[model samples]
Target chain A: MQLTQFLSRRRAQKAESRSPLFSFLYSRKIAPYLFVSPFILSVLVLYLYPFYSAIQMSFQRVLPGQVFYVGLENYERVMNPIFFRALQNTSIYVVLTVILLTVLPLMLALILNHRLTRWSNFFRAAIFIPALTSVVVAGTIFRLIFGESDQALANQVLSFIGFSPLDWRYEAWTAMFLMVAMATWRWLGVNVIYFLAALQTVNNDLTEAASMDGANALQRFRHVTLPAIKPIIVFLVTITIINGFRMFEESYVLWESSSPGYIGLTVVRYIYREGIQNNALGFGAAVGIILLAIIFVVSMIQLYLTGAFKKEH
Target chain B: MVHGRQDKLISAGLLAILIGFAFLSLFPVLSLLVASLSPASDLMRYGLAPELFFSSFDLENYRVIFGPEGSRYWTWYLNSIIVSSMLIALSLFFSSMVGYALAMYEFPGKRFIFIMVLLVLMIPFEIMMLPLFQLVITLGLIDTYFGTILPLIVAPVAVFFFRQYSLGLPKEVMEAARVDGCTEYGIFFRIMVPLMLPSFAAMAIFQGLISWNNFLWPLLVLRSNDMLTLPIGLATLLTPYGTNYQLLFAGAMLSIVPIVILFLVFQRYFIAGLMSGSVKG
Candidate 1:
């Protein structure tokens, strides 16, 4: 009887101290959902809904207020010669840029990791400053640097080196070269940072052991460092490819979307022209879907090849 | 001693190469600064020739940009600040909440939500822009700040980062808080939030950078001059006829200042954030 009376008094005290609002809010079963509902709501409205709408829009001819289903017509139109040209151009850019991005930064990171200079941090920071600048800014500066006149900096450098001045944006090849140069300049430092971080985790003792086993410096690097940083390399390559597909700002700023004969046009640039500029929403949706398909397939292949898909038990 | 001699020679060579690369990397940026400083008369006559050292340098371009004629520039900068601050706040609040729930609770649809986050992370903004533009139009958010920031407020990257970080947090403390009659929100706010300072700092920088540098989406939605962000405003300066190279260069240089300041202040967190976010895959 004494224990029961004490328990009842304690329960009454607990109830008196709890506010109704606090009790409602503190419910474990309900609180987690409330905490997470905002994100879930955003995902549904922003991502999932639009994602589904894009697929639906791809099948229909959408006007300002009217929409009608047109069954694969948009996809068929997206396969026109212009789309093919974009696909081919983007593929070329991806291959060349990926190679340069992967190789150059790896070399820079390896040298920095060797502690060759006391100013490594300063150099890293300086190189990374460009990466911070917006593509609009970088593109504008590059345009001026590679401007049309002989007085331009790039042309001046060429004349100084005894080479004739070339109009960089006038020709398709030269314009493409300018795009690649800008991308390499902007992204090299970012990739170097990635490689540097990965290098920090690499086991130095393994390298020393390899050297002691009569391995040359080149052999040691190939055997020790390359394998250790392979995952990062693969990851950077995939990003480079993705960036290559989405190469809008670089090319768009270098030359307008409607550059001379569509020489510098990229896939995303094409989408911008057809969709926003031309008001062909259905067509744009179809192109976006195609681009999505390409990226999804290539990324899955990348993951598989890099063993990124390997299940960890 | 001979081995030491070889090592010194190799180091010297490597240092020279690194220095050369750094010069190459910074040359264009330096040239942009030089262009911004070039006198308006020189820029008008000589046409943005950074190679021409004989031209006089002045801050007249910057003066013009910051002066009365540059009200547009200031407006755009203010818009960016407001948009990015709101973005950082909203993103940090909701993403961290969702991430915390994912990490702590075993509710239904957790795996599905996690997978959705990952899928959304892989889908670049360009792929989603068309339909998203349509949605924004339908919602009548065009020309509004909320429209500019709404779609990106709950960044999948932030959610993933917070979730990964929270998975490492001590679960025992949460259990103890429960036993002490503390509410779930109370534990998260009073206990877990204090523990998650580094993650918050990292996400702040990342989200801040994205919001500040975001261009393509803002360009699409923001039509009015007053509502324009910095990137879009600067992009308009590069018109096809009679481009104002001096003003443009000055504006570009000014645009980089805020981000550089952010980097200088939170560089360690920035590097930590990048390393963890990038190489973890």
Candidate 2:
């Protein structure tokens, strides 16, 4: 029926094409192209060209007005210890953040989603305020709070708890903890919003029936709510991992280009150091390609493991 | 009666937990605000302690920023505003057009174009940063506003969003406009644009926040000190030899004001826009 209607409409359009200027200007065949041309031109020039150039540059030694193909040299340079350290640090950051962001936000959303809860809107808004601040702002505050001085807030808390002050940036564990805490603080509310949206879609009738059938709150949540929001959880985890690998600003703001002993180095930071600051564009492009490969493989494995690709028969 | 009692207990417990987390979330901002208002000397001595709040409060740092000595700060602020405005305007215009066309038309290569968008979405920006920077240099657009905004103008995510949204728009309107002899461009501008107002509002805030807080791209492209955006400028104040706590804290706090105001006025759209990506993905 729709196809027949469309054909009739096409016939009418053809009949109305008596005016050459109107038909030429309003032809459906050409309008879409005109509409899409700007974006297509931009993507081809900015995105596709750069992407192609990045791959090509990765295999060459780029210099001022000159380029020479030195295949595998750039890739082999990426096999150094600092690069591996960055990879390890990024992986750790990704794992910790993905777990915390996924679990804690779901818990928060569940509480907020409770029917008897009061002032839920206020609580939601208050928590989400952190997400509005720039990472630079957040990093500045965290730096102050966790400063090396004994008078810093973190140290004050430490003294209150009977532990001595420790230099946060010097130690690997402390540095990792600070980065993870900052990320969680910044992103928790956004993830909670995601979960809350997904949770609202769950059928209240199903939960009511389960409760009437004598299922406890924990059991109902474990079975019904969890399964219902699995896709969102997978999606958030994938996004968090991607953001995690792309993390440069957080570490950059905290320690700038140089992290103490490279404890807080991230993959993107490594790329920036090699590409922009050091002027080894080829080396940086190589590291970026490797980082891309890591993200792709990890995301695919995660999707497969979570059964995101499996048909729901 | 028993169930009611149990429900009340659970509700109270949950509310208490929610309050604690909310406080945790707001603590950093509160501390920063207080520290921003405090004297720099007190902050330097006590290192952003709660005690400094009681000892003194001063607007000296803010005055410095607004005064002649801090002209560089305002320059960076203005640069950020200009870049963000151009980015939001151009990105919204171009991406929405592409997205609307993809949704409303059944032309050849539509599928291929959409697949290209998806491919772009999967690739992170860092992967292309070096080459893009090189391209900017090659084009002699370095340190220019166009260079900073060019690569991001056709954001893939925004295109995907507008496409998804346009799918839900009624097609009958387009047919009526066509029958009335309205040009296709006229239909989009006169008929469809007003319909997509909510989308425009949502994306405006979303892209505005991104471009305003954006650091890395601007850091690479904008080389002159006077051309620095807020983030990069504020970041440069913190050096190993000596740091400017007053300017750094105050600048950082001030940088968040525009976005915070935007959030307050359009809270619903902000949350909806954020959730839109996750919901569809």
Candidate 3:
């Protein structure tokens, strides 16, 4: 039935070649738009409308039927101490995770790139297996591992090493570190894959030339391999920063909106805490807008630094 | 390329470091697997710690997870499969169509559409969820499966990837098909679709992994027990009062199976797809 309809449609287009209306409607210029209607509808409904609603929500009081315009009140209230604390916590988390994600994965990728890493595929699979697991699952396991009790895996390991067991998430630093550690563990392999892909493009000839010029391995890599893969490094940095800002699941799963001193509260976590959990939809919308603005600025800066906007004259 | 004592030493050091990283990377998975295999008594005693004693190892946890009592677990698993499959299919279709039109055609507002896609890709989905939920509530799709799946069907990342892949497709072939009296839809469906199979495979894996592992939206939209996806369902097991850690760990372990199988089966395409989406325009 569909095939016959399609054929008849095609026949109509061909048969009505001289009709101006049919010709215009069947034109290639218009057909692409018709083909793209689904996406257009999706964007309009899903992306555009929701985005407009978020902006609208940010400016209103957000009470049902009593909704009234509140000019800059949400933004003013968003500058409270708690918001600043959340901001500080998020900044610290992003910086720490970005550094770890950058250096460790680069080092691992460098090591994995070495021909001596036998069964590299197996090693890669083993390393990347965690990436397949959901963050909630990993966070659950990590919570158990880093549990406050003596039976926790982390404390058990500590005891094995002749150290006394301690509550891992009691201290703010340790709790924050636990979340970071989980993020690092889950994403290490993914970053390694990124760097490995970049490493494949690094020409050995340049490194060999550097080595022949009396450079050591480190110097050779510094001058040759790093420059060759600069774009990918920049790309990974962008990805890491974006992901760092969006850190929610690690905290949500571990502490579930009950972290001590707001140590584990990321921007998105705060959004969830206020919007869904606290029933402060308007406040969450304001925070969400702020988060979006911060991400946008940071992304633009990263892109600018990487010369992503530069074009050949 | 020359083998020497210094090279051998460096190679050995590299191998050791890589192995160490790999071990650290696999620690959580290894621990999860070990905990899943241990009997519930031992698991509760040890608290997901890696127990070296083989005497405590058993299939009891798996039995409890897949047993007759674990019908809820099966529902969550089945719900995840259904939602993910629908998302993968619809995402592949609409995203590829948008990508194909953007890459291969000249139309009004093309640049604007492409820019929208790029911007959408950059904006985190978290920010939009609040209002999107409002939209969902207004549309009265709050707990419906279609509500959970609709907003996710046209993923910007998948569309971006398909656009990049389709940009590389030879336009001459499409033009030739057009000249051969094939309708545009027919040409795309029969001709361009086959040519873009690699992109389809790659997007399938990418979208499948994402949809299967998606937690936040599904958690917000899916309110009922049977409606919950795997991540949300498994997470609900960790409530403060008498949390069922045994079933949570076991279910969590089981949740890794489909995506792991997908990654293993399409491991080549997965990496290739990601690289293509990342390394180039």
Candidate 4:
């Protein structure tokens, strides 16, 4: 990014030596830099620098003031079984969340596309309210709602419906379900908006044609509407996958710090605990870099699979 | 059309589900409001209350969140406003700059830069979290507003949004300005900037929300109690009287206010930008 800026500056310099028209006109090139410079400067200071520093620190161990390089040792430790539990949980979540995110939103958008369900604005505003509330607040509310108490709404409903009152967040096997519920609550509406927008592009004639030919609503959706929003679904999938890997706040707030005591943690959150809180700054940085690589690989695979990046257009 | 009653049934079914979802999405806020207002003895475990949902009768919790006793929560809101406003200001600049660069100049590495932006869209704070922490420590920016405001300003998503709006703009207008001998930044500020008012407004709301609503980074970097943002302040509030459901609800609602009002007032721009983000994608 910098090299281009330098080259562009030199180009501007060359143009400045020409006729006044060219010099004065081409000076506009500098504006883009000026326009974008604040961001570049901020990112360089806050984003790029921290990114580089973390890598450097990841190589070196931290002990009080002293720090030194140990290379892949941190990576090795981070990949161990205890931490891999978090990885395993994260992997399952990424897959499940991506699929549900794609399907649920597509279905909701289709059902909502009906003229009878014309309160799109109202439903949208309400459903998206969770997205606005802080995860801390949302998690706390739900944690209280789902707390291990007799009056808990979920357990009350469960018992009312004839099932035993269950420990929602305390178990090993069922914990991811609670996590998924919270994750779903926060994100499902986000995709609903995305799908709703994509739905606007589906020609009404297409769905109408299906109905004219004795097609049912489900059939019309499966054949026509689904195909129109297929690309959007793919986009949502990729986003969901990335978001799943980045899941931290919900787990952090829900688990209240330990996260199965880091067992159900994300690779990113795991790195956070190891690097920042534990003061293994270098090891943490290395973990961060590796996590970056994992994300890069996963997303690349997704893009390649979906063929959404096709150059045919 | 197939069967009138069946159609009605399906329609009602869908409505019921949406209504149910709206309740789930909104019930937490209602509960928060109720819990915040209730007295210490009434801070019950977890039962639905008619008053919480039906009545808008509460002021004690609100007072506590903003009163001298709730100074910490109020400070968090102030910090959040400062940080979010700064972020909004910076993102608008960077986005305009990057957008203009991509729009007018045909740089050789433009494609690569665009690609980087796309890839970075996928690069959530998870990958950058630790590195960011280290970066802050090295720069002595930990606990400072700059640390929180700066990184968020360089958002690729916002940059892309700016670029898209800039593309639809008539190039001839800028060309006309060029003929008049306006400098690069001159045309940008006087010409393209004003023309892109809708984009600016959209960005102001989006960036504002991101800054105001953020919690994780603030939780990580900020140390001093005074430096806390609304979310952090709420967390602090959690500890001293963790048992105070009413107080917790009050603080949460306070945190929710700014973004909610912004979202309401700028509904059109916000929705337009949201729809635009999808179409562009």
Candidate 5:
């Protein structure tokens, strides 16, 4: 009551002593612009300008202090066999990682969310500890663990299981497996967090109703929990796909310089090699533009199929 | 009785599976810690094996990192701290302001700005790094902290997150503040910011982890030895000549300490904030 009276008194005197400039500056019309200007200016200068320049550079041949308009030559050059190999490898990694990350984390989240589960918080935090480490750190450790020597942890495990040790990095499938495994180990806990949060939103009464109707646990989850968390699933899948396309540090730190035979070369690694290492900025920018287009198209299609664009009242 | 038995059996199986996964998740870090502690010669001879019983542990690697040889490591560590701190502070302040403005005020271009945020969020930094590198060079910000922090200081993810978070805030307090003769700026800083503490805490950890573990952009911009961040510096240890397994292991182990502390401190807010961003979006 006192607060209300104080507010009323202040409101009564609100516009009393304002000069014209002060009134204009403090008006609703101008306040939002003031609040949003910093973000707008940064976006314009930093993001949009660089994006525009990337488009321009994609059509030219860039050298230090000189640029030539080569008119699609750079893009044409980026369409070679090496580029195709990177695309194929990246696509395979993306497909495998996305599927594994989504399905595995969902299963884990389900397990953790079980009513009788003990030490769920401990397990969650333990699993999440890996996500706190940098990719470089994780990649470096994985490299040593999966090293080509017989003494490496992976080989030791294999030999202990009565199997011959395999060179984990030289082959295509094995290298892809190693990359996917590293990504899963790092990301699984984080995804579980997403799933757990989504699971919490599933209505308990609805699940209880389904159970009362003689539905088994799987049936209840399928009919009740899955639909409730469908949005979160879609969001995770989309971002995972995006992250898959942007896979760089994993492959880079694993191989240290270059993946042998380019077996693990990702599209971003290709960009870094061409643009930064090899000094072919135009070609790199062209690849980057292609990657951007692919991600944009894939995301739009995924969102559309998932009804992300559909209006919800 | 039969149904209850089956349920217990299933729960037991699930518990077993969760334990296995949690073990798998932590095994790598345990091995890394072990590798960091073991003698470098043993690591080189055996290649980070699981048999930890026979090896002698020592602090030689950590001592080297702290000694004169590891002075550059500390420099990189300090650089990462400065960059991540500045990035988190500036980005949260500005991004939250924009988010608040969009959420609370009925302004022109609000939808356009929000759309722009989404578009920027979708475009991966890898695509932009090439052109951004050129811009950094042109602006003479190469090898500087400003260049490293400038492009990402107003991250679109943070903006979108803050915007989503701000929408759920109570508006009655703002109305009261306004009637109480508070200016719009005064209201946001004094009234709204306190309400959005959870969002800030969440974004801080999220952005903190990103900037701390960031390798590519910082690698591109920070050319000097002293300017490199922890990830970049640790990465350079794996030169083609030979790998510095000892320093690499110890440094990586230490590199994780700050973030682990941050996570433990803000563990609740981190997950809650992440959920709010995705679930609402």
Candidate 6:
């Protein structure tokens, strides 16, 4: 190793002594670009182009290959009654789901991360099953559970408790609540895993020091644990809000339409139904832009709330 | 963090509350299984009873799920496996290649490219669902397995995680290889990739779980009933045949089996991948 290093060094010195340009040519700059080219090519094709096309298509009218620009009309149409209902439903979905995503997972992390639990691993794997199960099947199963009869699980259970069996999905509010339950079931474990991972990074020293000073459990969590996992909390908050807007499949499964009062509906489903099913491509893109605007606004709110952009907390 | 017996009881009480949350999480699924297995005779006999498990057990549900023409369940099971495996293979190579480019070299727009990837990671695809579906239509990718697999292949999150892991690797290893007149591609392929085995495995497991479970995009694109993936197919089953609880539960059970197996085997890597992209293995 020493001899090889010595020879390489001597050769490099000789090359350097001969010509500076020779050295620059030897240390070529093209390698990085070469290594990174494939990735750049893919991003342009798959991501950047699709995004650009969405904005462009939202304004253009396509008729037998000739295109004409027709802007604000699409947005105007979107401001009508149907879109308003979807927008209202979208807001409700976001608010309800964000709560479930934050609390269920965070609390689950606290429980599962505890040293006192002997069956933590079992619970972890079991809880994760809902997330791992094919969403289609989960949707199918849930649909059956909410079917009109006392045949449905929720109705059956309620009936057994002296309440009459109710048609779960026929009623709008009950259907929305059930949708929230489905979303919560499928995601709680994945979020808990993230929180549990962050929990590991919580400084034992800080917690111990707090306890040594006779601080109680809630005090320690408030002063130490919560602050420590603040970044993860922010991330979870961000994702929950984003996912809220993205929900679609279960709604389509539940309601079977792009109709008014899609209680199980969310914003993404509206776009899919508009663009694909209804063939109103321009109108759908306008709706998508509106959803995007909300997501971006919520993200900024989170950034302001967490103060992470300030580097303080 | 210290808890006296009273505090322990209090925390334990809180933990039980969390357990109650867990039970709430588990209740619907258990009840699904309960309702599915509840015989038509029983529903006909007592109507949907809440205390389902305490009431009875039956193998009829399992039998219905396994029967080929008995339900459309078998077809959905087969479709899910084929499509998910194809996605797993496609993403492993594509993401690794993307990761390799970001890891092994520097270039103009390197920072811009990285930022673009981060932005993509943050912006959920539903925002662009309209145009992307339009694009897929133009490409004639609808109802095809490649259609389902193609969009998710160029994931920005995988690249971000890989770049993070790669940046922490010692630079001199690549430098030494370059000094030896090894082509940059050769150095990356031979040395860096072999060393990144753990990350590759980690990502493969992660993407497999995702692709296996994905429903929304597939639902939008796949029109023919034959092209239906498991979730889409399962949804269709319930619409017509769902009144038969045994067959529906049976179908649900089959969809879960392969995923549960994959999880049991790869749960450790699955857990670790979610935790740290930086972990070596």
Give the distance in Å from residue A7's predicted Cα in candidate 4 to where it truly belongs: 32
CAPRI grade, predicted model 1: medium
Full candidate order by DockQ, most accurate first: 5, 3, 2, 1, 4, 6
The better candidate by lDDT, 1 or 6, is 1
TM-score of chain B of each: 0.93, 0.94, 0.93, 0.87, 0.93, 0.84
Scanning candidate 3 chain A in windows of ten residues, the lowest lDDT window is A1-10
Model 2 local distance difference test score: 0.87
lDDT of 3 by residue, B224-258 (tens): 99899889888887654534565777888889876
Q: After superposition, how far is residue A36 of candidate 5 from its true place, in Å?
A: 0.9
Off by over 4 Å in 5: A1-23, A307-313, B41-46
Error of 4 at A65 (Å): 4.5
Model 6 clashing residue pairs (backbone): A136-B231
Arranged by lDDT with the best first, the candidates are 2, 5, 1, 3, 6, 4
lDDT of 4 by residue, B1-281 (tens): 66888878878999998888889878777766665665522443443343344555667776665667777666777888888888888778777778767766675567767776665665567666766766677789999998876467677878888888888888887676555555566567767888999998987876776677687788788999889887776665443236645556777766787677767677777666665455563
Q: Alpha-carbon error at A77 in model 2, in Å?
A: 1.3
Local distance difference test, candidate 3: 0.81
lDDT per residue for candidate 1 within B101-144, as digits (tens), equals 88888888888888888778777778778898888888999988
Candidate 4 residue spans exceeding 4 A from truth? A1-26, A39-49, A260-264, A309-313, B1-3, B40-59, B239-246, B275-281
Which pairs clash in the backbone of model 4?
A35-B97, A36-B97, A57-A282, A58-A282, A60-A68, A258-A261, B35-B246, B36-B246, B76-B229, B76-B230
Give lDDT: candidate 2, residue A116. Answer: 88
Residue-wise C-alpha lDDT for candidate 5, range B8-100, written one tens digit per residue: 998899889988998999889888888888876556445678776357788888998888878888898999999999999999999999988
Q: Model 2: per-residue lDDT, tens digit, A1-313?
A: 4564465556547745668765665678989998999878988888889889999999999889889999999999899999999999999999999999999999999989988899999999888999988888888788778878888888989999999997887799999999999999999999999999999989899999999999999999987889999989998999999999999888888787598779989999999998999999999999999999999999999999999999985
For each candidate, how many residue pairs have backbone atoms clashing (under 3 Å)?
0, 0, 0, 10, 0, 1
- Residue pairs clashing, model 1: none
Supply the DockQ value of model 5.
Answer: 0.61
Query: What is the alpha-carbon lDDT of model 5 when measured against the actual structure?
Result: 0.86
CA lDDT scores, all candidates in order? 0.82, 0.87, 0.81, 0.72, 0.86, 0.72
Q: Which model, 3 or 6, shows the larger TM-score?
A: 3
lDDT of 6 at A301: 88
lDDT of 2 by residue, B1-281 (tens): 99999999988899899989999999999888887887755564446775765766788888887778678888999999999999999999998999999999999999999998888888899999999998899899999988988878998888988999899889998888676655677678767999998998888888888888888898899888998888878888765444566677788888888788888889998986786577462
